[model samples]
Target: MSSRFRLFDRTAVMGSGYIFAMVNRMQMLYYILILPKHLVQPYMIVGILGVGVLSQINLFILAKYLTSNYFVLGYRGFVQLFSEKIVRFFALLGIFFILIKVIVTTLGYVEIVHQFMFPSMKTSWLIFVLMASGFYIASQGMEKTIRLSIISFLATIWVILVYIPYFLPPISEIHHLYPLVPGEVSLHSWYGLLMVWSALSGPEYLVCLGPWIGPKEKILRGMSIGNALSVFEYLVLFVACLLYYGSPYLEKISFPVVNMIRYLQSPVFERVDLILISLNMIYFLYLIALFLLCLYGAIRIVAGRINIKTNRKGFLGSVAAVFICMLIINGWYWREG
Candidate 1:
């Protein structure tokens, strides 16, 4: 909220909290929707693993820095090393960065919903409902947001387990992963693999959590564990995609992971993917709420620089000010796209 420049929740942040934070953040990227397209058939598996290893380096670095003696410096303390002008520049830049990220992610996810679930509904209405939910959660403060994340993580994580059928029988295409020869592995192949590395997002941004983590928590270690879990999750998902859909068909699917889930037939229901996405609604909402908090931090920085201040009662307005940009972007994008 736009109260006093509060740093983090006074409540304790545990190791499990850090793990779930990183897990939810990384999962929030919606990589399962678009990542398979970035990767080609041959080396995609290896690259996803490579992404895991390389991304950890970033996690460790963020962990290394986030371990401040000052009990996890919020953005204010993190910016002290820079001049006032640089601080202003970073604050402004961060605001734009958060705004852009929120806009793009919201629009993209809404489009996916429109494509699969709500083809008959108005996109504007969808955006309104989404932003309203986000505003409510974001205004409540990070404590609720963190709790929602843990709950979302636990709820949606089962979807991963339910995909076990993908590994066997009529689905498995592990044979397509053969031919790891020198001639077959070209530079472009490696480049496509490298592209998967970029899909390994969210961990590098762990530094932003410095203020939110509990005092006694091993922020770095928890983050590292989260990164490991994230990497392993991606690896499993990528391989599953690789084996299930092969090369030619995989590139054709925009949301291959979801598509794969759509085929899942449980004993209780036929279209288990619908249930998956339903429970998964929390993870998506958790993603939006968490990002809103981060955007709040950026807005706080800008407000401070401009000598503009708001009282604790102004938290809702602050949330609105931050999210209005996203609403505009979504409207414009709906028109354009």
Candidate 2:
């Protein structure tokens, strides 16, 4: 394959293909139920919708600028393309940043889980499962993984559509949604919204998307639509949760999104949050796979450039080992009593 084509394939194929498997039955339940805990009712609806919109726009700008600078413009006449040295530098940097973000996020999640669900569950087990899956999916290549993502995304939507009515009855007090903007929005509120903004940014997989689509115009159009839909979905769910659970109660819970669904109970269904947790796991797994792919691909390029392909496996293995160690270290700090 041509160098340009290989790079393009690497970027676009990996993250999205597995989207179907990304969210399993449980994660769909969780994403629908748990994520709304931070915002007030219908207003949270507005907030998250806003978050989705802003995030898409911001990400678009970021992706465009980054791609142009890195690939097209060529920094200071120091071209990075096809140069093993530059690729290795970037790969290492990527691994460092992603490790920091993943470790922190995973630890925070573990802390939340311990405080809420399965207090006795060892944190190490979570780390092990995540790392194991991360290694497997990432090693498998982008094409195979993205197919899973497609199925997972569709399955999640179907499940949510089926459960819509469960949240309808308690969705009273439409008046609570009257004032779109609350009185004297605090600095804390503004800062809190930033986190939501960042969350909507999605993964760096968009970097790969640039090459896969090839034509900038087509890639731009698709990304715009995809980002818009993502924002809409988040907003819709946020509003639904707000209408169902008042802001006062919703704000108190850590994973209010999942708890939102717990209110839904039938004679046949008990503790729907259990199912939601499973879905959340899939989302988390998706992120893990993404990080490892970027890390390993960079490693592969670096190894190939040095003509040390013979030890490529060992180099990639070390990359995983390092991430696993980071997970353990961060997990300890975050999980500490």
Candidate 3:
């Protein structure tokens, strides 16, 4: 029966390269799109760097857990660390966390598509399309979903190069980057730093992929490379925002990174921003699929069905429940602040 639905089956071990791709793509999720508006000061660059260093330290600790003997045992590892009841309790808590993350990420990206790509379209339809894509990818099972990380990374990584024009002369203003250090600090500045820290998250979730990722020794090195590249990307985007819009003007613009992309005048394509925004769907789908699988697994664990075979009805019902939750939130509660 388990062989019939091999969602959690591990046939071959993926290397450190997969780990690198997954970590980098996960950290560079939806938050990066609107980060510049929140971090509206030049000195916040320092905050990014500082938070990045702290994230690296956090990854080091995570590496220890990933490489541990117990991790290779998967669910039994948690059972050994705590008891079966405690593990189930954690899984129960995880269901809520996974749902929240999935809801925010899917709806956030849907809002972008609604505003920019399809202003006339209903946001609920956009959410359904995106969630359906995610469900398809996740249904392929964990190994293939993990493999999608590299494709997601390759597809969106070049979008950063498009921002190069913002950093050059003519478009860039020298004074915008002035006062590299903050003149005065406030609680708002601390909040901006906290955002950076939050952005560097998602790597810790790699603990769940122990059966697929290897060799154990290379895990930390791969994670470090991915983490470093994410920081570098953040620095480039934030600096380009500063140079293009300056600190004062940057605060007023929503989706500064996407807006910067809109300024690029391609001779062939009139709406280059739309094309790139669509390209972003690849990674966004990868994340949603990854989280969807994680959510389902957590559900099974909490339900004490970890040893049972996966069935189409159970999986589809779970995905449908999430889709319904997203619709309810979009219809009632989700308001951009």
Best by TM-score: 3
Query: Could you tell me the lDDT of residue 267 within candidate 3?
Result: 95
All candidates in order of lDDT, best leading: 3, 1, 2
**Ranking 2 against 3 by TM-score, winner:** 3
Give the top-scoring candidate (lDDT). 3
Per-model TM-score versus the true fold: 0.85, 0.74, 0.98
Which portions of model 3 miss their true places by more than 4 Å? Answer: 1-3
- State in Å the error of residue 229, model 1: 1.3
Predicted candidate 3 versus true structure: per-residue lDDT over 1-337, tens digit per residue:
6357668888888888989999999899888888988899998888898889999999999999999988888888989999989999998888898898889889889988887899999898999999999999999999999999999999889988988988889999989998988889988888888888887899977877778888899999999999999999999999999999999899998788888888889999878899999999999999999999988988998899999988877888999999999999999999863
**Stretches of model 2 off by over 4 angstroms after superposition:** 1-35, 41-45, 62-90, 108-117, 208-216, 299-312, 335-337
lDDT of 2 by residue, 48-106 (tens): 66776676666567557544645332222223454656756776676677666566555
User: How high a TM-score does candidate 1 get?
Assistant: 0.85
lDDT of 1 by residue, 1-337 (tens): 3555442454655455745565545644655567776665656666677777787787666656666654365655656767666776787787676666667667777777776788899876777777778766766667667667667767766667876788888879778666443345567666666656655666545555655665434665666677777767776777788778887888888788777888777788887766666676676676677777776666666666334543444455656665676667666654422
Cα RMSD of all models vs. native, in order, equals 3.4, 5.7, 1.2
Superposing every Cα of model 1 onto the true structure, what RMSD results? 3.4
